[model samples]
Target chain A: MSSADLRAISQLDEASRKDIAQWVENEMAQAKLRSTIHNFTEICFRKCVTSIGTQTLAKTEELCLQNCLNRFLDTNSAIVKLIQEQNK
Target chain B: MAFFGKDSEASSTQTQDVKQRVMQEAAQELAVADVTELINNMTKVCYDLCFPNPGPILTSADSKCTEQCSKKFMAAWNIISQTYASRLRQ
Candidate 1:
């Protein structure tokens, strides 16, 4: 039988066994999340920095950039929250 | 590396039997695309910030200024990301 068949059977006939499968899937999902955060940070850093020297980020620039990142996340969360809030 | 088991039979069992394991791969792909979109948005703003004057539109073998500008812009983006995330965590 195909693997799908095995999975279907496992879900229905072998409930206890399915617990292991669920845990593995969640771990994979978490790994994906970690990588995503890393990738975004890497590129965002590249676009923001202008000068070649190791000078510290200026206060105004730092605040603005920080705002940029937070606002982006906020926008995403707000959109979803608003959608659900409105729909429900 | 973790997936590779003692034998072929064991490895297949790890890969095929676990439905949850697939979620990691899906999450990775989604994150990659999300990051790309973020970079694109940030760059547009940076380009405008750096090059207020409508200079040459950046060809591959272009002027030195264009190269320098691109580098600095990326640096700003990085700073913003680090500063922003750290501040939020605080």
Candidate 2:
């Protein structure tokens, strides 16, 4: 990651600095979401689609992709829940 | 008093300038990062789908295959994004 222009940020008033910090946090959140989705697509594509000759995705392939995504998300939440329970 | 007045006015303008610069830079950085990720994934997925039999040149068939592969990859990406967003809300 590029080092943020800290000198410029330091010139802002407290309120303005707070606003900038909030905005940057939101932007980072969105970027994180995008990267996660990209990763999921790569994994699900490998799992769901075995053939590639056709220009269009077969209906079965589409369904497989969706199921792959659903299962992945399910696993994610289940693991998070398990971790929380373990901590408790 | 003179120095304080001048310094406050000058610093306020500088603050405004800096705020705009920081916000613009942040947005630009995020956009570049996102686009780079998309391009990288597209390259990898399309290469895999279209280059199973490697050739020196990309034939018309290979080009078509790559195009379709990219489209399918994008479609999958959208589906995953939607599913993940909904999962997060839950």
Candidate 3:
């Protein structure tokens, strides 16, 4: 974010500035998604791939990784739901 | 004598070009940053997985394990990306 040249954006015309704003918003969302995936991958990799046996992931290891991701999301939602209930 | 409109038109076009270039540069910078972060995380995760004991130098076996661990890490990333994207869509 600090690397970006904000001065250039300010010099743009109104229309061009609006276009850039929309494009940047989309890009930021995508970037957030990518970072989230990176975090989830690190977590699941540690949990699932306990040992490094081969270059390729074993069947169980792959399944475990997928399940770990799904369950993690489920857990996230469940916690949010619990918080909402507590507030109400 | 009536070149004022044409002058403004050219300036607008120039502005458009500048905007496009700025967007491209910003996008490239962000992409590079993302890759750097990913590599940093991978290094930490794989190093711990591959080298349980600290040795003076990396042996061939440890090197191979590091390679495999990186591959598995990337695979896990792909799976998570796909799963998360689909879930977001749903």
- Candidate 1 stretches with Cα past 4 Å from truth are A1-59, B1-62, B87-90
| Model 2, span B1-90: residue lDDT tens | 111111122277777887787788778878998889998988987887778879988799988888888888777777777777776788
Q: DockQ for candidate 1, please give it.
A: 0.16
User: Comparing to the true complex, what docking class would candidate 2 get?
Assistant: acceptable
Model 2, stretches more than 4 Å misplaced? A1-4, A81-88, B1-13
RMSD of 1: 8.6
Scored by TM-score, the top model is 3
Q: Which candidate order results from sorting by lDDT in descending order?
A: 3, 2, 1
The residue-by-residue lDDT of candidate 3 on A36-78, one tens digit each, is 8888999998999989978888889888988998999999999
Expressed as tens digits, the lDDT of each residue in B19-49 for candidate 1 is: 3444445456656766676556545644554
Displacement of residue A2 (Cα, Å) in model 2 is: 7.6
Give Cα-based local distance difference scores for all models: 0.53, 0.77, 0.81
TM-score for candidate 3, residues paired by index: 0.89
Task: List TM-scores for all candidates, in order.
Answer: 0.38, 0.82, 0.89
